[model samples]
Target: MRARTWRRIPPAARRLLAAASAVAAMALLAACGSDGDSASGGTAAVEPVTVGLASGGSRQDGSWTQAWYEGSQTAQAELGDTVKVTFVDETNSVDAYDKSAASFLSGGGDTWIFATAEVPQLVDKFAKQFPDSMVCGVEAPRESYAANICTLLPRFEQGTFLAGFLAGSMSETGHVGVVGAFDFPILTAELEGFVLGARYANPDIKISRTYIQSFSDPAKGRAAALAQMSQGADILFSGVDQATQGIYQAARTAPGTYVIPQYFDSWEQAPDVVLTSVIYNLQGVSQEMIRLAASGELANQHYEFDLKNDGVGKLAPFHELDSQVSDDVKSRLAEVEAQVISGEILVPGPDVLGTTGAGSKLDLATIKAE
Candidate 1:
């Protein structure tokens, strides 16, 4: 996942990449591998395809990394031994990350899916070095790439809107907390939409925002969640990947606190404390992308996902918290969903970050110290 790809993009430009389709694909090669193509109509030896999954953290990270793990598992299950999958975890170092991916490709892996955000920076290198192999970053930026490389981005702000609405409606302290691994463009969009959605339900909602600057430090996630709870946040969002486990711990210890998981369905982590989750349907995306590749059309065109697009961005099952979310709140959420799909609600992205709700800023000033 390229969590913070567009950090330098101006806020307005960020808006373009946020609330809309967000995925812009610039395909550079003529369609190859089409069924119509054959070597003089003679049958050639077919090379079997193998998928290699690489991540910066362990599968226990419970969010970004785990989501990709599940996606690959689903793909493997669907392929049923036709496609081989090799998984490598804990490759955060740039050199190690590069070597792992290259090793996979050199070891008969013809296709790759990278889970680390920074891995995409070397994508051009990978495409040039291993032209025969195509590479994809799970959540990557919008930049033109070789016909062998494609970046898929999800409009996550849509799901955060519904989560924010739930937080606002269920909060007992009128305060909600957002804790993230990094303040990347996508995460900024999530924060913006969260504030917008929360305030949409309760105009007086106060939000506390924090960025831990690391994706795998559980200690940081725990401390951040506790800090937010101490500041009167009854509903919190764990935007960190592996660190999210610590976030759930904080919410569990608190008497009446709720947490929202990111990138995957994490309600099973804390059945009662976790009210709902913003699920990124990467499993479905992986299946679709694989099909496209098999059909000779995987490269060039970028894939965009949001709630309105093939269930890319979605809310997980209500689980046991259906009663916790009142009928009015659920009804309002349904109505908001329609509005978001129709563009009636302009949930701010990174561009409109500082000021999101009723002229209030999504700054640390709102967080209480007590």
Candidate 2:
């Protein structure tokens, strides 16, 4: 939901209020609720917890931010009054993100969830400043053990690789494309996995990759997608946020073109042209974090969701495009997925993919482009 009020209060005041809130929450532990019998063999009420969620784009972007927002909503629905989630959207800059944090702290928020890849460093800084608050950064470049800080990373590369395999098998032009929001390390790793999987499917496949430098700029995203299409790319992967709208529009104009979106299952957005989606189990991860915090088990550590756990990235079902894929392709995809889960085909992670910078780390020159 929209965080309407931004109260800029002094740090001392905020800390005092936070402490007061904690004490008040502790007092609520005694409230009786009609749930199943607990380990104490009596009725027990869930602990009251307030979570602050911040994202770099609109919460309804239908991609990265939307996925996390939906996750938080899922947790809120399941936990009922025991958990409260307040959120700020469009935090695309350092100042905006810090201001959102201050707003959350002023409101006595006990937990902080930064749902964008651009704000991990900011989350680290906030964690250091507010040692009492539990802060988490999703998709951090690497794991950290700092006090009061937790990082959640999903093996998104797995799904992207699978998406690439599908694109490779379906591309009649032998050329596919990828449009990313930024050249961040995590996204680079995902796109690289896509390229690798495409190559695996068709050794001579042409893959064109580009970044629009923003998660919300639809015009730029559209232009980038059109450029790739001009070069004969008939299948495209969208790694941006709301900008996916533009990519979908471009796909619609090109009759044979199709798209694969990440983070959310977006087939309905463009049912005709959408092949499948790379789904990151953000709902499960978000709920787990809330549960951990509520149970007082949250600690400074890294939580990774991946294929091995069946808790992270996986491909969505091919909706209307199901009939377009051959049975052999589907069979091969299944075999490849099993190999990936079995560790036989290891997808390179962020460590090998390189970090965020001005441009992508992948060597576009290494692969021939038509």
**TM-score leader:** 2
lDDT of 1 by residue, 56-156 (tens): 77776666666667777777777664566677778878898789888988865677767555656776688777889888774434555677887776667
Cα displacement (Å) at residue 137, model 1: 2.2
What is the clash tally of candidate 1? 6
* Model 1 ranges off by over 4 Å: 1-45, 80-82, 138-143, 346-370
After superposition, which runs of candidate 2 have C-alpha atoms over 4 Å from their true positions?
A: 1-47, 140-144, 355-370
Task: Evaluate model 2: give its TM-score.
Answer: 0.80
- lDDT string for model 2 (1-370, tens) is 2223214666787789889999888767644431323344433565478888887777887777777778788888887887787868788897898899987976667889887667777877888788889888866444338778888878887778778888888789999998987787788878877877777688688878888988778899899999999999999988887788899899889898998888888999889988899888877777787777766788888877888785466889988988898999999999978877877777666666544321233443342223
Q: Please, what is the TM-score per model?
A: 0.76, 0.80
Most accurate candidate by lDDT: 2
RMSD vs true structure, all candidates: 16.5, 10.2
For candidate 1, which ten residues in a row score worst on lDDT?
Answer: 22-31
| Model 2 superposed RMSD (Cα) | 10.2
Model 1 vs. true fold: TM: 0.76
